[model samples]
Structures are given as C-alpha cells and as structure tokens.
Target: MEKFKNRWEITQNWQLIFPVIGVIALGYSSFKIANAIISKFGIATIVIVSILCFFLLLKFTLFLFKKLENKWILDQKWEMIRVFIVFAITGSSSMFIGRPIIKFVGITKENLNPIVYWFLFIIIGLIFYQILLVFFGWLFGQFQFFWNFEKKMLRRFGLGRFID
Candidate 1:
C-alpha cells in the first residue's frame, strides 16, 4: 500500500481514487473487448479471455506509462492516469457529439456519396474532439497540460495562426 502510494507520489487519500478508478475502467474495457471478440463463447471462456485481456492491457498501459513518463512533464505520476481518463472520455464523447451534428445537418450515406459523408463525419468529429479535449482536461484539473497539447496539435495541423 505504501509502496503503491509512494510510487505515484500520492500524499493524500483523495488522490487514491484515481488509481482505483483506473483499474475499474481498465477491467471494464478488457471485458468489453473480450465479449465483442467472442460473443458466442461460454461464460467461462469469456471471463478467461477478459482476464487475459486485463493483464495484456495492464502490461501495455504500464509500458506506455514508462515510455510517456519522460516525454510528459508532471508534478506527480498519478496525474498521468487522470490525463488518460480525460482523453478516453473526450474521445468517446466526440463521436457521440458528432453523430448528432451529422444527422442534424442531414448528411447521410443515402443522401450524399459514401466517401463524402464519411469525410464530413470525420471532420465534424475532429472539431468536437478539439473542443472536448480541453473541456474534459479542465474538468479533470489538467487544463494547462491539455491546453498546451491542444496548441501543439493545432500548430502541426497548420492552424497555429488562429491560436497565436
């Protein structure tokens, strides 16, 4: 317990919630993936697959954590989990948000060419992703980190003039 907390620089009890949430989220994600991949399997098989996926995901996440630790500046290591959670939420919400906007704009494969419809859908999703990323970052108390990230991304997209 002490080692886990110390590793993440968790000095306060409230900060412990992030790690717990991260585990639950990861477990749910693993189960979802396993179920989607083998819906016809028995319960035992699915559970086994889910458990396997959980470990695989854990290993992959730890690998990413270590790799990104050097690239990202942070006051505490636990904050990285929070940052990842915000990104997950923002990315999922962006697709839902874009779907409604696309329907509202009356853009559908049946009406428009499939390629054009998909192109517009992706464009709208990206726009919402940019907006939601910062919003979720602020909500999760990582505004500065994601705001700077947003700026760097925009610059790469050649939209630096709008921000500067």
Candidate 2:
C-alpha cells in the first residue's frame, strides 16, 4: 500500500502523548501529597510538603524523559535540549507565580525562615517545569494540527507556505 503525505505528519508521533500523560500523573501525585499533608499537619505543613512534592514531581518527570531519550524513536539529544529549554521557561515563570501563591498561603517573610523560603522556590521551580513538560508533550503530540493551523494562518497573512 502507498502512504499519503501531509504537511503536518511529524506531529502525529506518540512521543508527545506519553509526556502529557506523565505531567498529569505528576500533578495528581502532588495534589495527593498536599492533601495528605494538610490533613495531618495543617496548612503550614501543606506549604512545606507542596514544595517538596514539586521537587519529587519534577524528578519523576525528568526520569521519564530520560527513559524516552534512551529509546530509539525520537532523537534523544534534541529532545533533551528542547526539554531543558521548556524547563527553564516554565520553572522561571512558576517561581513568579508560586512565590505569590506561597505568600498568600501564609509562608511570608515574617513566618518563613530563609532556608524554608529557598526550599520553596526550588520546589516551585520544579513544579513549573513539570507542568511545562506535560503541556509541551501534549502539544508535540498534536503537532500536525498546530502545523497546519500555522500554515493556514500564514497563508491568510500573505506569508508563504511553511514546509514540515
């Protein structure tokens, strides 16, 4: 049988789907940890454990991505570079968000020690990175749609066609 061709075919790869699923799983685990900590230790504990869970979630995500890189399908080196870029963007952005959220939850300058503050920042950074991992994974999995959509938009804007 002959195969058909399309401009966005590369986006159909399963490499993307797996990562998105991983992200969701990590988020759920973090949520569960938060709930447990809150139940047993109160809101303060929730703040602390939420920070720890973020690190654990990011570690889990990185481990999974490492496994994917070892597999033969997607180019591991390229995938890792892209993942790191995404991690950097998301991690920084998350700190901006997480810091405020943490403060809102009562872990403020007055209440939290310097060590605890730094720990929260690190954990929140990881949490943000994991969130991006999942999101980019899904987006990569759906590349075909985005690719074609971009092409269509470009065409509408009088830009020339984009090749995959």
Candidate 3:
C-alpha cells in the first residue's frame, strides 16, 4: 500500500485507491478492444500490427504530454496518465453513443454517399464528444478543465454565440 501510494505520488491514503482503480479499468478496456481487433484480423497479423501501433501511440501520447505538461493543472505526471485514461474512455463513449444514433437516422454508408455518411458521422460524433467530455471530466474530477476545453472547441466551430 505504501509502495502504491508512493508510486502514484498520492499524498492522501484515500486518493491512492482511485488511480489503481482507473488503471485497472483502463487495462480491462484495452484488453477487450485488443481482443476484438485481434479476432477480426487474425492473431498473427494483429499481434505484430498492434505492437507497432502501441509503441507509436505511446510515443505520440508522451509527446503530447510533454507539450501540455506545463499547462496542465495536475502537478504530478502520473495524474496526467489517469486523466488521459479518462479522456480515452470519454472518446470511446462518444463514438459508442454516436454510432447507434447515426445508424438509426439512416446515415450509414449504404444509405448515403460514403463521404456524406462519414461527414455526418463525424459531426454527430463531435457533438457527443463535447457533451461526454464534461460528463467524464466531472467523473474524473476535471470538470472545470474540460468545460473550458468544450467552450474553446465550440468557439472554434463558430458556435461561440451559443456558449454562455
């Protein structure tokens, strides 16, 4: 318990538990996603491709973290990892929510031109992403940060007038 607390840089005893829970959840989700992809692509091909993709993704995430490190509210590096895990879950949730809506609306590639289908899909996904960003951020105790980010994203999309 002491080692876990020290490794996560959590000063409070209660705070130490959440990061462990977050990591376990993240690992489970990763495993499920990897298994799904591997089943689709076959074990040998997916194993090789997944390894390469994992390293590339790790590198890119680390680079992104380096750039945002100074600006991020969390002082500890491990906290950022927890935040990233939340962000990933939020993104996946958004996609999961968006896909069924898109299908229900008959916006699939079979029903529309491929480009139009994708465009609509992306637009809907972005809307869900904005909403989920705040919800998940609140769950992860970063609501203020994601709320500001959502506002900035809306402003960029020319929806600034709608934001209060």
Q: Which stretches of candidate 3 lie over 4 Å from their true place?
A: 1-8, 17-60
Going through the candidates in the order shown, the clash numbers are 0, 0, 0
lDDT-superior candidate, 1 or 2 = 1
Tens digit per residue, CA lDDT, model 1, 22-131: 99999999999999999898888999999999999999999999999999988999999999899889999999999988999899889999999999999999999999
Lowest lDDT block of 10, candidate 3: 22-31
Can you tell me which runs of candidate 1 are displaced by over 4 Å?
Answer: none
How much is the lDDT of residue 45 in candidate 1? 91
How do the residues 1-164 of candidate 3 rate in per-residue lDDT, one tens digit apiece? 67766765778766666666654664555455677767687777766665665565657766887898888777666677767877888888989999999988877788789999889989899889888899998987878778887898889988999987
CA lDDT, candidate 1, residue 5? 94
How close is every model to the real structure, measured as TM-score?
0.96, 0.35, 0.73
- The model with the greatest TM-score is 1
Off by over 4 Å in 2: 1-73, 76-81, 140-164
Q: What do the candidate models score in CA lDDT, each in turn?
A: 0.95, 0.57, 0.77
> What C-alpha lDDT, on a 0 to 100 scale, does residue 90 get in candidate 3?
83
Q: What lDDT would candidate 3 get against the real structure?
A: 0.77
lDDT of 2 by residue, 1-164 (tens): 01311221223554454445545655666777798757777877776787789788788766766776655244333344344444444555677778777777777667778898778867766556445555654554533333444455457756644432
Our model 2 lands, by Cα RMSD against the true structure, at 14.7
